[model samples]
Target: MSNINPFDKCPVYETINLIFTKVKEEDAIDLFECYSDPITKSRMNNDNCGGVWDTHNIDAVTKGIKGWVQEYNDRFYIRWSINHKQINKIVGTIEIAPVPNTTRFWDGACQTGILRIDIISSLENKIVLSEILRMVSDNFYVDLDIKNIIIKATKDDGERVLALENNSFDKLENSTFPYSDYYIK
Candidate 1:
């Protein structure tokens, strides 16, 4: 939405080959198609595991993607559609948030924290992830002065884990939530 150039050259920051391009509102439909499909949803079993669920009802998903773009377009960082060069299709999405210097998660010695990334299973491969992480680490994360990278993906999301491990993502910890209450209620 904003005219900010996400791919602008910066002398202070080094650029990674993978570009974190903003996902447009119009692209939500395609995402829904990918995310809602049985094969696609089965590949990644996060919150949207139950076949898109009712969260996609009433245009909520579309609105959320668009709003996220507007909010994080020029913020410290944000997510982007993972556009594979060979495939030439946005097989997945990833988030890169630049942690503030003052956050409690900082180690004091590091000026910047980590850039978190999220991805779908469609792009889950060692080679594919290696290229993407290289792009992010070299082009985006390094420029942000970040020392670490974090990823939030599902356990069944093999591609994300494979890519994360290939990119040197150590497991922080495990997080669990009571799902039946949220869904049934």
Candidate 2:
């Protein structure tokens, strides 16, 4: 298990246009808007493997926030709500955690961190997204004390793939699991 609760020091990063703050229960509307968008939902693949989530109701998002709180109890996951400070809205979310518990018996056990990102549809938000990617990459790449960091990228996410590549995250193949077809850091 992890020695320190990473959430305790959850850093609040700010850019000229955004604020990355610890997500709390008060962010229901902002989170709901983020998770309910069709494009965001489709890209996240939260329904299957990724810890990302898609919700039809604000209550579901509230529950998801609680889930993050419980994940802290398990000492495994923490999510940050990406708030646009000027607009007073949560435009997206970012989650970082130890990879979920599985693939140990056959896949080999090792310490790893997974970063999950989700944002509402904004055709002009590329710069904001890029900055967030770099910020998190810098924090997690060597600072997290984990051997590896994994990012789940869909085949069509060119911008995201490019950001990961810019941060020195190559196509990680078979560190512990067979990710020959997956991009990781």
Tell me, by TM-score, which candidate is best. Answer: 2
In Å, residue 166's CA in model 2 sits off its true spot by: 2.3
Candidate 1: residue 183 Cα off by (Å): 29
Q: Model 2 Cα RMSD, Å?
A: 4.4
List, residue by residue over 112-151, the lDDT tens digit for candidate 1: 3344343454455666667766676565544444456544
C-alpha-based local distance difference test score of model 2: 0.68
Model 2, which residues run further than 4 Å from truth?
1-5, 47-54, 100-110, 123-126, 174-181
lDDT at 42, model 2:
70
Query: Model 2: which residue pairs collide?
Result: none
Clashes of each: 7, 0
| Candidate of highest lDDT | 2
Over 4 Å off, model 1: 1-19, 38-58, 73-76, 100-120, 153-158, 173-185
